[model samples]
Target: MTLVLSACSYRYGRVRPYVLRAFSYELPDGLTILLGPNGAGKSTLLKLAAAVVVPQAGRVSYGNLSSRSKEFRREIAWMPQSITPLPSLTAREYVAYVGWLKGLSRTDAWERAQQALRRVELTEQEGVRTTQLSGGQIRRVGVAAALVHDARVLLLDEPTAGMDPRQRRLFRDVLAKLVEDGVQVLLSTHDVADLAEEADHVTVMDRGRVLLSGDTGAFLVEAPEGTAPGRVAEGAYTALLERGEQV
Candidate 1:
């Protein structure tokens, strides 16, 4: 099921002049990465798709179904930029609680929670309380929470914002495995290093609007202008913003 956004718009401040412009995309399967710097409207796009906020105009849909339906909540899972796992609960318990909240039976919740943790490579940390885990592990726990119910589309916002290089690699490996297993992963991040290698498609945004979206294959090519290939996205993003694309 492709997640489609049709002429969608949103804004933070109540003032009409402050609203972000409308944007749309029919997101594909596999790992689609949304890249942008801070306040570039990346998280806002994810939030709109997750139905956490209704847009001031247009609509978000999964295939032909509207995002406002109960079916929408049942089919899509969202892990926001800031996640607070229950401090008192173990990693497995937190995931299971999320599963139950998503309408699973207690027995199914426990079972799926175990499976979800395995997907994020947190199986060994199942018994450890969330408070005891490292930042990366906690982030994986949040991803596991989103994975518990087998949601078709997973929306993650800036999940690797503060991870160490090693932790970031580990997390990206987990995501690759999920893509191999056919889960559609849509994530937002300010950094594009991982997207250079891991993403199937890349969508770039700034100041509440999409700047570009295309196959990651093109983005992975050696960039011109004597820049490092790894820094192509970084360079392009800066250029786009400098051009006043969103102003």
Candidate 2:
């Protein structure tokens, strides 16, 4: 299954400039990393894929399913940049609630919530109220919510922003496992050094347009000779943007 965007255009307000203008992309299976600086329209693209916002022109679709279709919505899960705590809900409760919203039965949602929490290594904190958990723990809950419904497509925006090194590694492990299970993941992040190696495909966007996109191996090959191993992806991304600027 793949998510596709075609000639999509969007903006926050009628008078404001467009965040995405005639943007288009087709998601590849496995994990794809979306790299961009802040305000690059990365989040906007994910939101369109997630069906959280409708484009003023063009469309987002999953195969033949339209973005407006309930069936299409059920096939994907989205985790936004910010994970807000539900005032009084425990970690598990919040996840279960999300599953319920996704069309799972209450009983099934509650049971799957446990499994989701476990996948994120948050089983011990399942009963902890969201208000009492630390920021990283709360972000894990957001991920669990997205996983609870067993959706085939996962749209995650800046998922590792608040995570510590260990937590981030654990999150990467979870994503790798999901990909092995045939889940398609499109994750947006600014930390290219941390996730470039994890991607099967890498797409870089700037100023509401795609700068470059291709297989990870091909992208890494763009780095100049003698670039440090640790910064290869970052180097390639920088070189692409710099080249664009010169045009």
Candidate 3:
């Protein structure tokens, strides 16, 4: 299914609010990187697409289905930038709980939860209380919860935030596998290095508005004339920051 946003805009409230202006894009079953500076509304846009937030104007639709519809809700899985777990729940229990909420049978929920824990390399930590885990470990548990249902659309906000180099690589590999399986992924990140050779599409946003959106390869190739070839990814990201400042 194609997730399309057409002229969608969002505002927090009437006062001290900035507009996430009308922007349109179609996301297919592959990795699309959402890149932007701090407070650029990357998170807001992801939330809007995931139906966690309503748009003030225009619409976001998945194929022919509106984002607010129950069908759309069932098809999308969202992982926020920072996840705080319930201190009392064990990692395994949390995953199982989310699985059940996603409509899995009790037996099936446990089975899927176990598989997800293994996939995120947290199987050994499953019995540990969420409060006992480190930040990165907790994030892994969050990822596992998102995967337990095998939803078609995955929206992740800074999935690699608290991960170390090894963990980051593991997460990337898992994401690659998901994309290969035809899962549509929309990921927001400040790490430009993570985007190279992974993202098929790129959308750059600044101050709650999209500045540029297109094929990743083309964006890298068309960067400013003085940008170093070997450092295309870094240079392009630097350019984006400069552009953000201009706005």
Candidate 4:
């Protein structure tokens, strides 16, 4: 499934007419990342793609069809920046409930929940109350909830937001594996280092505008005379936004 944003614009009305006046993007079937600092319109972009918010103008489509179609919604999973599960529900039940809401049968939802939990490596904690899981585990449960529907596309906003360095690394590794399995993933993050070796493509945004987008290598900035060229996402972030200002 391909997610495309064609000249999309959105903003809180009665205030600013356009926080994202005419942003456009295309995501292929791989792990495509959105890189931007806080308030750079990253979450807004994801929300449009997820069909959580309708654009004020232009189009958001999956495979050239509007996401409003029930077929598309059933196949797409969205995890916003913050995820909260019912405190009384078990992790497995939480995932099953998501699948059920997506139109799966009771038996199918329960079956898929088990497999989804296993994929996120939460089998041991499936029976635990969601409120009792560690912060990271709860995040994984959100992913599992998304996966239980066997979603064709995943729109995750700041998936690694509160994780430590090691946790971030592990999450990145998991994303790589998902790519191998052919899941189309759109992930948003401000931490360029998170995409160092994982991103297949990158979109850089700032102040409600898309500054640059293409293969990850296209935005890389050459290292300074003294430092290594490693972790170029940081340099790319600066170059794209600063260069846009000059234009």
lDDT of each: 0.83, 0.90, 0.82, 0.82
**Clash pairs of candidate 2?**
none
lDDT of 1 at 59: 91
Task: Write down the TM-score for model 2.
Answer: 0.95
lDDT of 4 by residue, 121-189 (tens): 889999999989877788888988888888778888988888887777767777777678788888998
Ranking by lDDT: 2, 1, 4, 3
At residue 15, give the lDDT of candidate 1: 69
Candidate with top TM-score is: 2
Per-residue alpha-carbon lDDT of candidate 3 for residues 43-77, written as tens digits (9 for 90 to 100): 88888888999888889888888998977877888
* Cα-lDDT of candidate 2: 0.90
Instruction: Please write out the lDDT profile of model 1 over residues 1-247, one tens digit for every residue.
Output: 7899898878776765534566787788889988777888777788888899888889999977788987888778899877776789999999999999889999999999999999999999999999999989999999999989998788999898788999999999998998898888998888767565558888777777676677786654424477775577666656656655636
TM-scores for every candidate against the unseen true structure: 0.92, 0.95, 0.88, 0.93
Q: Report clashes for each candidate as comma-separated counts.
A: 0, 0, 0, 0
Clashing pairs in 1: none
